[model samples]
Target: MSVLIKTVGFSLGLTLVFTGVANMLPQVEGDAPVDVKVDLSALTMDDFVAMGEDLFNNKGTCTLCHKPAPLGRAPDVQGTNMVAITTERLADERYQGKATDAASYILESMLEPSAYVVAGWGKKGSDDAESPMPAVDKPPIQLSDIEVDAIIAYLQAKDGNEVTVALPSPDAAAEVAKSDAAPGGAGAAPAPAASGEEGLAKYTCTACHALDSDDTLVGPGLGSVGARLSEGEIRQSIIDPNAVIAEGFPAAMPGDFAEKMTVRELEMIVKLLAEKKQ
Candidate 1:
């Protein structure tokens, strides 16, 4: 009986020790990836261009790799004219794919990135050169066709080039909305905002704008925006950014904030930014 008691006590002590160790260790949690969906039916050509500019600067992550200035990793978008580049590339014997025009060339670049690997950017010594650029329609980016159209429009308009594609009608967008409501649809509802910081992170505001410093990243620093612009102007900037762009910054603020942000979330962000006068 004494032996049995000793064995049971030893087992209990071991179990307690294991439980304590488990509690002391850090807990790691994995979150499922969120799908982003935007309804573009109601947006006009101007709206699309604006949204595209936002995606380019933020969600699209284009600026992370491509820059206006010449860099070793990726091509410079600002210095070169895309229309002229596309026309010239079509005449190249090394060029592959069915892109016949400037618009198609841009579309092909996004869709089939590996089709034409730009010189010096491709994988070295491989029989078929591979491009570092991932397909924008695939994972990590997963931009919708409407979003793609908007980005293309942005690229065209930014250089003062002619916009070749027309935006879809509102009725067509309504049809898309209806289809999305059906079983196994691609569309997802907007994410809930827990706080102003979460809302800013959700829309990827930190990717371009900085709160801590006056130095610009992609957009103007918001460190002193509260001192500069009124609350109403700040609110307008969130929804309609191009209305008044800050000096020394490109008018590339995303125009989809009105659709992406809830009224409460927008107010929360605006209030937080308004407090950043210093």
Candidate 2:
């Protein structure tokens, strides 16, 4: 009986130690919640544009993926003339929304990013059928409706296009607030899954490259990156994106992925990407 008790105690100690070690390890996957609010009443078009520019650079995280010039990872916001294209998309057979003009079209893009993906940037395996862009109003980068409006205004004004949406009055803003506070009012959408391949989607990698095919989106299709680069090279590319920019691609990849990814998370992604081969 004494020997049996000692064995059980030892097993319990080992279990506790293993549990502690597991807890101490860094987490490689999970979703972080975001709670954001913004009020756009009583601001001028200039104010909206200014606020929009700030948000784009900082809060919106737009500059992380988008650039003024065409980068293989994402679209060039400036070079593409987003405002003008928004208006043009209205006549496109792929545009399924009721946006009659540029402002509404831009808003639709923000709210329903997958509705109309730009060519060469769609999800893989679908023949340019789906968009990889996350809804701006969704999690990980949740922007309120008014904030979205400001971004549109900024995109328009910066590109020398006409800003169509006027700022709301204080009374109108108050009414919007009331509606939001009411039952069944504005609420956050479901957060994206944060593990495995879904984790890649959560990070919006599909925005630029496909995982399973060689079809180039904005960046080189990562279908067979392992065949071309070593594991160390793959990790380096994520940590120091410009270290070895692939040929025929701009060195516009964001350099902050190292700060955003955990060591284990980096390993997972590298392993997945390495499996791709011609």
Candidate 3:
């Protein structure tokens, strides 16, 4: 009888231990830590307004494109100066059509700059005709944690006193960097070089153009380009686009100065393209 009792006790103890272990396991699926997933039911409007100011001016450098009207270098808040502009934009029928609130719209703008361009903002003939805003999510200028939170706070405050969706803090920025460096992350593997003649295969020139040499895609291609243009000509063609515009190619190819691209990278790419045989 004592042995039976001991066995039962041991089984109960093991079950409790397993239960404890299960409880200790980390949450595997859901929004990322940096991802703004928490409910902002407790925050206040004053908090967000302060945050927005920081983001607009120095934090995320949002003013660079929006060209604040008063400032001219940043986006101008037309309603009640900068403080009230957030709410005004939130109420504006145009932006609100798709976004749930001012805060969400602001956050989305930072995350996906290409999704919706403010009307009449983009270059006359460019793909982003609706908005000319440069993508802020790209490299070399990642936003800090405090900056994201400040921007989020500013937008939430504009909506007549509501819960401010506080973004993760600066400490979170380090985590973002680590995640990006991890395998398969955005900064993971360098792209493979693709031969232009093989047809645009997604990663290579295809990103900016179509496959056929003559067929117009985002940029012109190699049908007779190899035979006609010398290596120097091709290299010059890219570095100094205004130097020559192919018969049908648009003159708008953005030039990459030595300031933007290394000499080695430019030379290698130019050489590879120049060597392509018809």
Best by lDDT: 1
Q: Candidate 1 at residue 106, lDDT?
A: 87
lDDT to native, each model: 0.68, 0.65, 0.47
The sequence of per-residue lDDT tens digits that candidate 3 reaches over residues 33-134 is 122322234334454456456556543545433443533422453233333454565565565335556556666666665455555443335544344343
Name the candidate, 1 or 2, with the larger TM-score value: 2
Model 1, span 1-278: residue lDDT tens: 35434534543454455453223222211121223344565566787788788888766877755876443236876456888788778888889788989889989989997798777665334333666566788655667787788888888888889999778666567666765676434443334455777767666676567677675555667899899888878878887888898886566676666655545566678888888899
Model 2, range 150-267, lDDT digits (tens) per residue? 8888888998889987775666677667766654244442232335475465555664666787766556778888998998788788778888998987675667555444444555
List the candidate numbers ranked by TM-score, top first: 2, 1, 3
Q: Show model 1 residue runs off by greater than 4 Å.
A: 1-42, 70-72, 124-128, 175-278
By lDDT rank, best first, the candidates go 1, 2, 3
Model 2 lowest lDDT segment of ten: 26-35
Candidate no. 1 TM-score: 0.50
* Model 1 residue 236 lDDT score: 81
Clashes of each: 0, 4, 14
lDDT of 2: 0.65
